[model samples]
Target: MNASVLAHRSMLAKGASGAACLSFQLNEQTPAIFPMRQVQEVIVLPAQQITPIPNMPSCVLGLTTRRSRVMWLVDLAHMLLSQPLPSNIRNYNVVIIRVAQILQQQNMLVATAHKHVLLGLIVPTMKGVVRFSPDLIQTPKGHFAPGLAPCLRGCVLQQDEMLLVLDAEAIARSPILQSI
Candidate 1:
């Protein structure tokens, strides 16, 4: 992980940056865009009862079933930034991703059903992917939701609009994750 971060930082230093268009919603508005490609698959998580962790935080929704395995379900918005989650999410997708390089370096077991490292977010839709450059992203400024400040990675400028980018790792490591 350390080497990867260093490599990413070095790449950024050498004018290397990429973006992934993540489709998210905050009510009736269209899916909000987020950039930083790492999403693998959009899956429908089972509606099984979750065993809540005692003394966990509010944003953490708890563990749920996905492909016969128990995976943590987290509040994407609250974890990323303080952006509120959609009021009604009939169903959400569990984005399964893996850091193969990191796993190899750390000697971590190649991700499998029994021993897996995954992060699941409750999203309204699976927005198509969009790619962008690092210089194209802008940092947020001025008054906004307090919780959102830390988790925001950057903002992507598309055509004539801006989309908030999120740090998946930050969200995964949030206090909210304690509940999952």
Candidate 2:
């Protein structure tokens, strides 16, 4: 099958939450909702360990080691828009996402035997957890407010404000990230 088809089948789909909810606060305004199952973990890293990658874009915060794996943590505030990060930025959380794709070598697709599926992305501050409904999502259009559109899949309107659900894939491929 093709990549899109495989992605559709392999991508984490929302399942039953067992009555427990997952939640997070973005900009202290909206509560981002996500299924509990998809979350791998929420970690706090030392500020010094995050090495700066010279010549990298502003959004690329540099590499972070989690679970023995070096992950490139992207400042969601800088990755999304120019909003200020939470006061103890060193204690921020990184959201790691899983992606599956066959590697291409010299323009040819590598077979399954040589293909590799891996984790991508590191978003700061995972507030908590909340159940999300796919039907409630609505993708934004037209001129977006800065970096919001590229990373945001849509917004879930709440009694207080709008929760922005980020698209893991889009965030990984964002120009700001690839330039790193």
Candidate 3:
């Protein structure tokens, strides 16, 4: 297994904490992180599963089925940078995310409400998981692309590299997703 996977598994074994985060590259030059609490799973896109949706935003890649549930796939790079993944590229990596939690009430008439939605984010590469102390994360400063600032939680410096931590819930609730 890769170092990232090992790191991720080790963190999972350590139990839930804000210090654990999944790290992945948005592109060759950009690295980002997501709180592990929101990530459900990560997988490589199967060749035949991606069914492209027509007339949607360029970022909307399409939909795919995973474990009997339909997942909407969006290209994070395209959404943030307005640069879609190259057409010639075939393999894709996706991070499955659960946006929120559902509250269950036994006596209530409406026992089940659609509590949270699953979203699949297509990224150029998956870097595995990294564990950082909460204190390491610094408040976001400096300028960011207007499109990306809203979803960023903050940034952390790791091994001399800075990684932007993203809030998956914010991305899931973004107006861009609702507009489609």
TM-score of each: 0.62, 0.67, 0.81
Q: What tens digits encode model 1's per-residue C-alpha lDDT throughout 2-65? A: 5654455455435455544555563244235544355656677544554456655655666776
RMSD of each: 9.0, 8.4, 7.2
Worst window of 10 by summed lDDT in candidate 3: 104-113
Cα shift from native, residue 60, model 2 (Å)? 1.6
User: Which should have the higher TM-score, number 1 or number 3?
Assistant: 3
Order of quality (TM-score): 3, 2, 1
lDDT of 3 by residue, 40-152 (tens): 99999874679998998889989999898898999998887676788766778999998664344676533233566789999988988887766566887788877688889
Residue 122, candidate 1: Cα error in Å is 0.7
Model 3 misses residue 137 by how many Å? 1.2
Which residues of candidate 3, in runs, are more than 4 Å off?
Answer: 1-18, 101-114
Whose lDDT is greatest here?
Answer: 3
Which sequence of candidate numbers ranks them by lDDT, best first?
3, 2, 1
lDDT of 1: 0.56
lDDT of 2 at 68: 79
